[model samples]
Target: MIPNVLTIAGTDPTGGAGIQADLKAFSANGAYGMSVVTAVVAQNTRGVGSIVAMEPEFVAEQIAAVFEDVRVDAVKIGMVANADIADAIRQSLDTYAQCPVVLDPVMVAKSGDHLMQQDDVEAIRERLVPRATLITPNLPEASVLLDRDVEMSSLEEMHASLEELRALGSQWVLLKGGHLGGEESIDILTGHETVELTAPRVDTINDHGTGCTLSAAIAALLPRHGYIDAVRQAKKYLTAALRHADELDVGAGHGPVHHFHALWNNAPLQLQGAQR
Candidate 1:
């Protein structure tokens, strides 16, 4: 059966990140996609220009509506702008606690813009992180969660932080080391056991939606595969998407990964000028 994966996230009009990326990742990974919008963000490959948050009550209502109808096999949570929204999501998710939840802990955009409120970090760490089946946080995000002034810089530090992050309440923790400069990108997963996943880093400028896509991919695969296997497959998927990202021209800044890279045999057809 095709798993029904739900992504509770903000929007990216450019379709490179946020809810758009999540849906694409879900479909790419052979899962039926569903969404609950938490914010409407005006952003592109360049950066986040603005974000308009949804009311906490309405966010709760959307979750309720989905749970009433859909059999969500797994869920990917991203970009809750404030504490109220986090609380709302936590309360709603309390009812349907069976499915695997992958929380990306998206605090800052790839463009260096902050997507969340400074005060909201506490809520995510305290309320949402504990509830997630797995929490994927990069070095910067992990540092923020641990209230550290500096990011983890080495493999030793990453290993240390993985244990610390697992203590933050999630059953599993994936600490991404893509921020570190190296020939290979490494991630540490700790839960039933600790293992390091390493992939040859692809050199690319178009990596806009990597985090969202990865977490979504994991959620899509979790219903069928175990946690460690799902993460390995998701990592492979994201790496391929990144490898093929340069084939498309989407924006001036960081472009989106080619989510359908493995499936598309032909390049996109460009249209000539015509009457609108």
Candidate 2:
């Protein structure tokens, strides 16, 4: 069976982040993509202007609607703005717990605008984090979860944060190092094992939906590959996207990664957004 990946996230009208990016990432990683929108964000590569969250009951209904008919291979959760949505997702996910869940703890936008409520942090930690097969967090998110100042300037710090984040609950934790400026970007993965993946930093201003893309890619690959192989493949795909991100020329500020770089540029079938 083809792996069908589901993304539960907010919407970005600009189409670089949120549900849009998840869809692109899933498609790029060879999976059929589906989405349940949690919020409609009035934002762009520059920053978030405003957000309108979906009702808790409605979000729960969307989850039910999808799970009832579709055999989801994996679930990627992002940008659940409030406690109600968090609770709704956690409660609804119980029926689909057999499918692996990849949680991308998206608390803020790349432009530093807070996308999640401060009060909802505990709810996510208590409810959603435990159920997650894998949790991917950057330095700031890990710091918020641990309630401490985590400076991820060094590999040692990244590993420590990984351990602390794993303690909060998650079968595995991936601490992303993109936030830390270095010649090489390193991401630390811990749980069943401690592994560090590093890649040369791609200097570009286009990284709007990176976190969502990486987590979604992981989910997309899980149904077909081993945990380590999936993560490795995701890293390779993300790196290529980052390297060619400038070609998109999306906005004046940060743009999106070239998610369909291979498909639209060099593959046998030249699949564009609508065509896919």
lDDT of 1 by residue, 1-276 (tens): 889999999999999999999999999999999999999999999999999999999999999998899898999999999999999999999986579999999999999999998899999999999999999999999999999999999999999777778888999999999999799999999999999999999999999989999999999999999999999999999999999999889999999999999788465544586456
TM-score of each: 0.96, 0.95
Name the candidate that leads on TM-score.
Answer: 1
Q: Compared with the true structure, what per-residue lDDT tens digits does model 2 show for residues 1-276?
A: 789899999999888999999999999888999999999999998999999999999999999998999899999999998999999999999966578899999998999999988988888888999989999888888888787764557777777666678888899988998888889888988879988898899999998899998999999999998777788889889999999898787987789999998877775554466463
Ten consecutive residues with minimal summed lDDT in candidate 2?
Answer: 267-276
Best by lDDT: 1
Model 1 segments more than 4 A misplaced: 266-276
The global C-alpha lDDT for each of the candidates, from Candidate 1 onward, is 0.94, 0.89
Clashes of each: 0, 0
